[model samples]
Target: MNRLFNLVNQQDNRQLLMNTIRNGRVANAYLFHGPEGSGQEGFALEYAAMLNCQSRENQPCGQCPSCHKMKTLEHGNIHLVFPIRTGSLEKNDPPFKNFGPDDMEEIQNCIRKKAENPYEKLCPFDGKHIPINFIREIRRKIYLTAPEPGYKVVIVFDADLMMEPAANAFLKILEEPPDKTLLILTTSNIDAILPTIRSRCQRLHFPALSTTDLGNHLRENGIREDRINLVMRLSGGDVRQAIQLKEADLGRLREMTLEALRMIAIWKIDKVYDLVNRFVTLRKENPDEFDRLMLSISFWFRDAAILKAGKPESDLVHADMQIEIRKFVDYYTELDAFGAYSAVDNCIDLISRNVYINLALVNMFFKIHNRIQPGKSQ
Candidate 1:
């Protein structure tokens, strides 16, 4: 298979870009908008290589010098930008003003990781923004002619992290980009980008990967069959997240989720409160673990809904716990099961938006409790 096509499953998108390349009508600026891990950056790199490849074929010939340079992200003509912190600090610490040596090392490490695995999420510099100074640097670099006399490609990963000043500064270049320069801005959250910048770029919307694609990728990466099935169901087509969850303490998370569900199912209000308090404590001490717990709970309800709908057991995310799921389903009508799922979904949303953890989980428990009771209409 061609190296570029192997990076993504969106054949139509590949064909569109190939046609543009063959026709010599490639756009000056493009916005590759999609969920993280959908291979936006990989596609951008392959597209860059294709644009500059000195091959008879239109696709990037892996044998070409340009293609080899692109593989390591060392092509002089291609520039890369992504979110970086200004100072050395723990991830939860407040942002600092000056870029330090440690910060530079961290940024380089992230870049190297991306070169190795395009689907990997970069280490986050929480509470930091892509500063205006980086935009100015990009502005200076974009105007310079490509050393090799081909296209000058600038790829901005996580473009939505740009602060107001940085975004505004970028608009100047977007308005009048240097000849033969291609700017590609990729973002998981397109609404965070400035309207002016968005209007200047040709938008390419990437959909989530299909379950089959995600499963294949996991299997190819040597994930166990059971783990692959669970991760596929929980990931909602997000391969990056599936990889993360595969490394997590999934058994513990499932046990916690089952305990919480048991409390709700048995109408033990006091025990439910205790469970919610435990979750609140976990949120304060280890937020990532708390998130995994919440995700596990959501998946549990999803399986219950599947069982209630008479779906195949093979379709359940918690297929190993089919007996437990079937028992849970017997307590509710299909509508009730759906209502429970929606309640859990709302709780997940609220938690994401920084709602009080105890309140959100406790309310979610009560909602599920109400839905599970016979003769109750949710």
Candidate 2:
């Protein structure tokens, strides 16, 4: 359970942060801003451990008394604020209002697994978003004196989930935290958070991992070489997502995308209708898994385009789908390729808006089908 800052993959960013620690210019409030699964929370936890370690030379010794406690997230001076179920507040519902020890345990498990295997599944849920009651609890604790010899580090993960009231309620503390207090907020949805809160914290953005790095990470994680290309293309340089993709089964979705493309290219209205109906059924029966299907379809066209251009298998975004991509490219026109991309973008936009999943997927099918066959426009 060594600190995440000590991770070999993040040495460069760690060095930059260490320089700030050495200079004694630590800010009261810091924001780790980036997309999900970029290692922001791990970085924050490592820094907190370093800040509280009894024998901090350049980083946390990971062997000291303070380090041991911090590793388990039980350090008195280090606090965690995250979202919890409202049921936790009701005696008949659960324990701890809006947050409890279980929330902490879930996060701890994810962190531990991530540290053990860099390619472990990466997800944005660190036990839900920050609730208003959780904010109140944090305010009460931070308003008091430090519990240890060093700084009081309060790491708030997924800060963007804060409701408007909670965001405003915490603004005052961010502006003027108590002595020896440090606030580190991490989130992928920074825009949803209050501008006032954003302005108060020193922001650090974590970039997406490089494609080569993601591929190498996947290879090391024992992912099958055949599926690595599809995962990398669909992940778009997000290693966390790449790892998740590795855990999914995409054979059926691959078959669906190929047939859907073929139907659209031939201007077969009945076949297109059948495809959408089947997809809608698949989505309804497996609502939680629709996103993977969408991603598979999206990557199919990406690989097809590369195949059409006579690109080598290694040059394809979905190298693993070379055979499938070549099959589509053999019959698909340039117009068909562009149409598929637009459909995917439209589906993403609609999904983000919380639209009905079945309707959105069907609409995307119609849009792509019509683009390929003007005569079948509805």
Best by lDDT: 1
Error of 2 at 48 (Å): 0.7
What's the CA RMSD for each of the models?
5.1, 5.3
For residue 259, model 1's alpha carbon misses the true position, in angstroms, by 3.6
TM-score winner: 1
Find the number of clashing residue pairs for candidate 2.
1
Segments in model 1 whose C-alpha atoms lie over 4 Å from true places: 4-6, 86-97, 227-229, 262-273, 285-288, 308-310, 323-343, 349-355, 366-378
How does residue 79 of candidate 1 score in lDDT? 85
Global CA lDDT of candidate 1, please?
A: 0.78
TM-score of 1: 0.82
> How much lDDT does candidate 2 score?
0.69
lDDT of 2 by residue, 78-123 (tens): 8776654443343232224344477657756765664454334323
Per-residue C-alpha lDDT of model 1 across residues 143-168, encoded as one tens digit per residue: 87678857899998889989887799
lDDT of 1 at 72: 77
Model 2 residue 160 CA deviation (Å) reads 1.8
